[model samples]
Target: MSKVYSTQELIEILAQERRSCMNGQRLNLAASVSGNPVIDRFLKPEGIQKFSAYNDFKAAVHSYQRQHQVSGIIWCELTMKGKTLRYPAIDEQLAALDSDLKILKAAKADLLEFWYTGIQGMDLYLSINFGKDYQKIMPNDVKEVAQKTEWANLYEYKNYNFWEIILQLGWGKPEEASYKRGWPKSGSEYIHAVNPGKCPIC
Candidate 1:
């Protein structure tokens, strides 16, 4: 006879497996900031003018890591008012970038994943696997789980990759018209149109 496990038990088991699989891969704590000067100004400290220098930003991130005991950081760039803006101040950006790199070095993890998205219609996606986690949770497995879940719809892009679908669908975007209605359990198979909001993964 086969052993039976309750839903909670199964969930716990999966969580444990995920944690073990994620071992040495680093945590997923990330920071997302808007590129708008107005937003940046609002976030600035009172009285002391000028946005915090990039060096300052690095120090702050380091401080945060020290206090929270988290791994490296994922930096995400966003647009303001539908217009894409270049990351100004290369020196500062590089400083923060270096700080993150140092964190990764200390943690002994591989490269950190950096992500940036243009206007609503323009998006980019990339998949990152660390340690042996990929073996347990493949892209197809994620698709299958998403198919079994429900979520909301936002928008769809022509180029849909595993990471892109995961991010957008996680945010409640509706699957594109071209997407199929089945979950892929393995990379060998394919899913047609997928419904974002209803994706079983997110």
Candidate 2:
């Protein structure tokens, strides 16, 4: 049997893992090992099991998804140090930008969720699902929003900010979706390796 962890619990676990990493700089949750006490709890065939390495942990996750036929939670770390755009600031700036474009109100696109996980520095988790509305909300729209938004704090790395809204896994077919080394690229890395012919939104 597998234990189900709530989204908040997962976030906390991810935060703890982030803090344990190299000053939260190389915190890749998907590629992380099962050293965290909480990892086994989220795994199926549930009994306290230890994965010796990240490959073991990854294999377990893939196995669980294959057995359940569902897409597992994918955490994409958006920014390591969101000097001006952390949590409420990011929400506020995005809200203001949305007000102008009426993007959310248009009922065409989804920004998904944003989480402000404060580590030794600062990190923000931004999840955007441009599935159905990929036609209406072009990738440029996200860049424009990020460009137009005002930073609450003084930040110098605005040029480094990029939206990971280019491609999404074919969620409808989770069974076939293989776990690549990095499917959803993280931290300002634009997804440039999508198959246009296979990807509906690519």
TM per model?
A: 0.16, 0.22
How much lDDT does candidate 2 score? 0.30
Mark the 10 consecutive residues where model 1 has the least summed lDDT. Answer: 108-117
Residue 75 alpha-carbon offset, candidate 1, angstroms: 35
RMSD of each: 21.6, 16.4
C-alpha lDDT of all candidate models, in order: 0.30, 0.30
**Tens digits of lDDT, candidate 1, 1-202:** 6554433343344345444434522232232345678886666232122222322444544454445443333333333335432221112111123444344233211111111122223222222231112122334444554454332112222435432222322111111111322223211112222233222222
Cα lDDT, model 2, residue 58 = 39
* Candidate closest to the true structure, highest TM-score: 2
TM-score, cand. 1 vs. native: 0.16
lDDT of 2 by residue, 1-202 (tens): 7676543443354445434442433333444335666874575321212222322433444454345443233322334335322211111101122232232223212222221121222222222342222233334443454443322111112224332223221211122222422244311212221223222222
The RMSD (Cα, Å) of candidate 2 is: 16.4
Q: Which stretches of candidate 1 lie over 4 Å from their true place?
A: 24-202
